[model samples]
Target: LSTTTDNGTTALHFASVGDASVVLSYLTELSTLKEINQQNYYGETPLHWASFTSLAHVKILLKNGADPTIKDSKNNTPLHLAAQAGNSDVVRFLLEQKLVDANAENSCGDTALRVACEEKEL
Candidate 1:
């Protein structure tokens, strides 16, 4: 279950990136919290990828102990990715949870709102 790809992408990372809810559920259930929150070579957690997908993916990730506040190599949180992807529902869900730091800045010193405005039409 802890196996990863050449770049350190785990099963959980693939599942989250593909928005495979069923696989995510199974993997999260079978994996430990550390495994669920495992960072790839780029320092991104499964939750980070999930944020760029759907709210369903984000929900499953969070419910299964994926840390939303974790930063990637670029210092971007899950919320940062979600906002940049124009996923308002995912962003809203994450904001409501309050686990993520809404005020977090990435390596470029851009907040999620700044990323949102710059990346999306919002």
Candidate 2:
């Protein structure tokens, strides 16, 4: 149970941040995988958090049928967050799924690829 009452965080949020296998498995049994993609107070989905951290949860959630193209309140998708975090693993993973909108811009009008270029020396 979350100590914060208003955050309304789902098991997916924590799972995406890192290795939350135990909780994730439990939640999977209780709820549908699509429910894991639901948002929290910050309007971030599980895929968003997972990609941001370059965690295996990204793959886990993906395999469980999570949508990679969903966006947050800032109009940033999981791919955008992954690029900003410079997580090559997550970026590659997202690319392989072919769900990312390469031309998709954030609230700032920058694409995820653009954000990646800004963060990486390449």
Q: How high is the CA lDDT of each candidate model?
A: 0.88, 0.75
C-alpha TM-score for every candidate: 0.95, 0.83
RMSD of each: 1.1, 2.6
**Candidate 2, position 70, lDDT:** 81
Candidate 2 residues 1-122, lDDT tens each? 23233686765577567556666656545657557667777778778888877556777777777788788889999988888988888888777768787789999999988998988822
TM-score of 1: 0.95
The whole-model C-alpha lDDT of candidate 1 against the native structure comes to 0.88
Q: Give the per-residue Cα lDDT of candidate 2 at 10.
A: 69
* Tens-digit per-residue lDDT, 16-43, candidate 1: 8774589888889999999999999999
Q: Which candidate is the best by lDDT?
A: 1
Estimate candidate 1's RMSD in Å: 1.1
